[model samples]
Target: MRFATVLAVPATILGAASAATTVPVTYEPKYDNGNFSLLGTACSDGQNGLVTKHYDTAGSLPSFPNVGGAFTVSGWNSSDCGSCYQLTWQNNSIYITAIDVTQQGFNIALAAMNNLTGNLAVQLGRVSASYDPADGSKCGF
Candidate 1:
């Protein structure tokens, strides 16, 4: 499956996006058409479920939760079908704070505001991909 990444940076005087060590995140990959899996050969096991990829290992996201879902990426908020954010943190060690998210699909959407702190990064609690009929590509984070 094609993967996108968002980063959150904390521990600094002000929130800044910095480089950090890599971590693997796992989730299911769905096509924009809403039917079948975008699960690529990279994602080999279905019964085992999807695999978590390193941010450096993937693409960009729509939002960045402040420091560990505590804050937003500098100046960004939720915008459905909008762009994604790469939230990250820094200090002794850099890591993922949280994924600030937006996209449209299914019956549920991410509409909660979080204020987290510490940790370089945190994996997404969950995700739902909606099928875009025109282009037929994945566009949800």
Candidate 2:
């Protein structure tokens, strides 16, 4: 009976580990200059439309011209906050965090995309960011 209980525990743990879903991600180079100018100010989140308002995270301001493969995902959800993703694009693989969301849920910033792929004009084929449930890294979350 003791052996059977231990075996069941491992199986249950494995089952839960396998439940993490792989989300497909695609992004285009689009600059959100509106949000760029408001950093470090009271209205940085979107006062008078001075910037493109991002989903507020506690007290952090959205980094504009987003760098370092910083990405935006679907919406503010408890399950999504503090999640990490393994993004891959032709000969390159980087681990980036999911921040905000837009009509196109998963997107890489213009500057960050440019850094990832040398030529912004080059179309990335089958780009994807795989979510890893165990990661505890937080960006805007």
Candidate 3:
């Protein structure tokens, strides 16, 4: 009887081990392959006359514009207060850069779109000092 008990213990242990799910974890928890693209769109807070550009993409990591291969251009946050955002990439990497308003003009145009606010543009050191759009000389604005 004692001999049978010993055999039963080992057999039970072996059965449990073999019965475990045959999942492919690779010690990696999960697996992923990279390939990607981005789609950009512009949205406006029309009531406030503010336009925002949005970029969204799925695919993999190596296809971003001007960003390089393997080294992903994903995952980013702008530390520049007022203007900030975060980006995530499949390669588990990150890159952060300023959103140049001058190039897109979305942000600047939003500010100018409101006729009421356009009046204030002259005071915020805009178009040089004293809000003189026609002044040939720089007012250190």
For lDDT, the strongest prediction is 2
CA lDDT, every model vs. true structure: 0.24, 0.40, 0.21
Q: Write the per-residue lDDT of candidate 3 for residues 70-97, one digit (tens) a residue.
A: 1111122212211222222221212211
Assess the local accuracy of residue 58 in candidate 3 as a C-alpha lDDT between 0 and 100: 17
Rank all candidate structures by their TM-score, best first, as comma-separated numbers.
2, 1, 3
Top-TM-score candidate index: 2
* Each prediction's RMSD to truth: 19.2, 8.2, 25.0
Rank by lDDT (best first): 2, 1, 3
Q: Candidate 2 on 1-141: residue-level lDDT in tens? A: 355444345666778845644444455443333343323322223322112345332123333333222233233342343245554445554454444444432465555455545544247532444444234333332
**Candidate 2: TM-score?**
0.40
Q: After superposition, how far is residue 6 of candidate 1 from its true place, in Å?
A: 36
